[model samples]
Target: MTHLKVGDKAPDFSALDEQGNRVSLSDYKGKKLVVFFYPKASTPGCTAEACNLNDNYQRFQSLGYEIIGVSADSAKRQANFKTKYGFQYPLLADEDKAVIEAFGVWGPKKFMGKEYDGIHRTTFIIDENAVITDVISKVKTKAHSEQILGD
Candidate 1:
């Protein structure tokens, strides 16, 4: 969904989290970041993906990486999803697609033979310097952490 690749400078973005608190790329300055873009909150695939990350949250943290999930869901929806799943990371409510567009994950997708515009399930692993080190375009929802950590 995105043309971005490893070694590309990650684009900066600012958006609201589930609590309406502002979140920006700058907040993660000096830390590695894992920014995963999903289509929605609370859906089966999305839940599996998020839970996978949550289950392995500490591993990423131990490796000096902070994870953030982004979707076009409303703040209320994001909050509910986080609360329901006990996610260890904040879910960004990018209702306006600012962060989504900035990352180039908002585009057409096909599922069950139906085509529609939505956020692509892509994950970008950015270094502390804000340069992308890996771009996971074909995300494996249930085993995403292993995919990211390569373990």
Candidate 2:
């Protein structure tokens, strides 16, 4: 699948949240969205990214944006991560990689000279109408929320 570009309609998906509650992309219609795809739950980079978003979550809400994190982690892992970090947003469990693949975030990756398929740290800013406004591909985990909010 091609990487989604600005002006592309954000792909709609439904997934289970950390608490096993159903979440759908369409559920947030008429609100801007920050749909972030990370490699795993509780990993250093992922945690940093998630925490950055959590820290600035109120600001995001003030700006009329709903934040969501997605990964191939199980619901239990996502629940633990959210509780440990006190995250206010939902972390969707994409254990089947369906949502990740639809967003073009699941692909080959290399670490320590070993190539494997995994989620690429990426963020999509979608408008109220579901059109993607920006694609943040090379995300800096520590300053992620700042970058997303254009700080």
- TM for candidate 1 is 0.98
**Tens-digit lDDT track for model 1 on 34-147?**
999999899999999999999999999999999999999999999999999999899999988999999999998899999999999999999999999999999999999999
Over 48-151, each residue of candidate 2 has an lDDT whose tens digit, in order, gives 99999999999999999999999999999999999999999999999998899899988788999999988888999999999999999989999998898888
Candidate 2 residue pairs in clash (backbone atoms < 3 Å): none
Q: Model 1 residue 103 lDDT? A: 91
Best by lDDT: 1
lDDT of residue 9 for candidate 1: 92
What is the C-alpha RMSD, rounded to one decimal, of candidate 2? 1.0
What C-alpha lDDT do the candidate models reach, one value each? 0.95, 0.93
